[model samples]
Target: MTLKFGDPDLEGLKFLQDDPLVITPIIGNCHVMRVLVDNGAFVDILFHNTFIRMGYNDSQLTPSDAPIYGFNHMECKVKGAIQLAIIIGEEPREATQMLNFQVVKAASTYNAIIGRTGIHTFKVVPSTYHMVLKFPTRNSVGEARGDHKMAHSFYVITLRPDRTGGQPAEDLVPIPFDPLDPEKVTYIGASLDKPLKDRIKTFLQENNDAFTWTVAKMPGIDPNLITHRLKVDPTRKAVKKKKRTYAPDRLEAIKKEVEKLLEARFIEEVQFPEWLANPVMVKKANGKWMMCIDFTDLNDACTKNCYPYQGLIP
Candidate 1:
């Protein structure tokens, strides 16, 4: 079935550009609001405040040690994880799915974030420009429109220092590894003692080549040492995805990244091959665009290794 967005989808939304798609969905009998739909996120998140407000006790959460990193590269402590049934849309058109959410204690305007895993479970197609989420139903397509006003309000709150409390002044401090080039630096704990800090600086200065400041500085491993080969099923038909167009800003970012890779000799131009995929652009928390190739089709055709390498259990 064909699912498309048109002028009708933008009927109630305000003409605010760059607004995140925020929706209110029914979670475990409660109508939860300010849930951000982020395709970039791998796992669904539930804020500690919202988790408590939902009439859930701490005992209900299963202990987990998995680390969750934010766009700033700082780890967000996970209190635990819990599975909750979430109902999206309304009436007969709605779809229900039990989702696992990682509970975080970080202060934020969003109560929850529905990530790629949840989106895939519901087979959802989200459009930030239209501010709507469309999913497949039994008969027809079901839509859950976003709250533009709430999104705008949350975005405004994010810009305010009082709401977020900002970062601590002494959290981390840059320590220059090279005195001649002050720009070549690394971060260290600001609370470290003078002797320890001096030792660390000395150690880093001695091993300056180990730190890769840029992608161009990386000297990749030799293929003869360890090479990776895709075990694609010979019987499966090769799929070539259609080229997708991107916005001007995203297009420029992709072009710049591709040029850098070319200069670094990491990627070379190739003619039409059997397998083809499109590139995806994700906005980083630091206001930078990260380009990633979509390898879904390629992965589907590859055979899974039954005897995969296993790590030691702790």
Candidate 2:
């Protein structure tokens, strides 16, 4: 049935202004935040990141054979479809629909996209002018109100280039998460099917000890499975390079990284290191510093595998 609105429904139009209409919908069963209602989109979509946040594992996703292409002509692999229970709004009014969402890994302004398929299924009419969505429930016409304030915040959260064309000017604020603690391990976003969601919660609880919360608690890899051996040429004497200096900020970052490595037992302080490799500080795209080692001298001295392995094409 086509959507019809009264004067009372049109009253909400004032909130629209220039902001995109974004709503919080109950997907699967969790109240999924930042759902964009895009009438242009042909199919419903659940972002891969949002799918995980819904406490779903890859195993639960059904494989999709079709490749989805965007308006930009970029082809994206469909992760698979997930049947989710969608609740449009809260009681005493709500419209419920069971939908198959094609899971994708692309980044977007919203967590999930309620597209044309969903619009047709739920018989929803979205009003950008009204800044709200209207749909029919069994009892009455339900509304999923758009959050104008939250929509604006999503813009700020998106990664964007600054004038210098370096790192993104804004990065997502870090959320404190503990993988080992089951209580703290709850997926903070979205609604999901209770049975399936509870199953995932139980899975995390059961395997709590399997997660390594910090580097200090790491047990490390066993030598029998795999080990790295530096094949340095003994004939060529080890080159102990002169210590390199870094800027104050870079020096602090290097020192902190070195201390972490020592604490994690990944590296140990020795009175004298035969092959001294200087620390290299590099700026990351997120405006963070990465500490690396300059092993050019060491790598140059190592013997190359001149002969190719058997069965490898030349």
Candidate 3:
């Protein structure tokens, strides 16, 4: 599905909204907590709390060092991106998907945003309206362990104009959305199972206010702005800076670090328990352990946040 701007034409857009884009808060390097995925943001991570918590007091971020933007549509300061581990999918059948997210600093509850900047690096095709992510698998179907097949695959919303003619006038901008308001959110995930997709579509249809946001953290803009631009980093220029040392420590510390790094050679990521989806059990299957989350009654009772979106609120 695709979305187009300017003039009325239903054939030009497939309005897949970014409902509840899979937002994950990952804890890495101890005391480092931030949201791993925030679909709205094109680039730049704002981590006001993270920097404070990490004991980097009185240090200001460099805005010109690297261009950063926010929901307010203002120039934002960007710190560097540190790697983090984010558990993908729901419990029982869940798997660990290591991702490299920008260490964003923000004064809001929206910690560490894994923007499209990081997502585009991987194989992702998003069906925004359905709230489903179509990502690719890493390992081949044969050598795959357990039910795991896909690598780190995340999808994005593409506003494609309708190939079929004869329809109503459509919005000439990217789908409008409110990240703060629970009601205005578009749900995104791995699948659009019948029940889930129906629930999502019902929500979108019922709430005409539901739309997508291209520039997260920006405030106040014409609702019709469709010429959205994502921050683009020249891969060639960035790679010119040769790799830096991990940490200068004792030989013993260095050896241990090296070994640990080697073990995680396949994926550059961090590890944690809370990231595990299902309730872990004691077992050994083909020299591997079973990890899963029991998302039974817990999800039903989960309460929404308190912040009501400023403009989105009727």
Which numbered prediction scores highest in TM-score against the true structure? 1
TM-score preference between candidates 2 and 3, better one: 2
Candidate 3 structure lDDT = 0.39
Query: Candidate 3 at residue 27, lDDT?
Result: 44
lDDT of 3 by residue, 1-314 (tens): 22222233223233322233344333444423324344566763637567557544434433335556644566644455544444433343233445544445434434555567645643344433333444444431111011111111111111211223233233222222444554554444434476875666667656754344332323445548754433332231211122234323333454554455455452254563222222323234344333223432332223322222422321
**Poorly placed runs, candidate 2 (over 4 Å):** 1-3, 6-16, 162-314
Q: Candidate 1: list runs displaced more than 4 Å.
A: 163-314
lDDT of 2 by residue, 210-257 (tens): 777568889889999999899887877888978777789999998889
**Alpha carbon lDDT at 45, candidate 1:** 95
* Candidate 1 lDDT tens digits, 176-241: 877788888888888999899889988887998798777887898899999878988798799988
Best by lDDT: 1
RMSD of each: 13.8, 21.1, 27.6
TM-scores of the models, in the given order?
A: 0.55, 0.50, 0.31
Overall local distance difference test of candidate 1:
0.83
> lDDT: which is higher, 2 or 3?
2
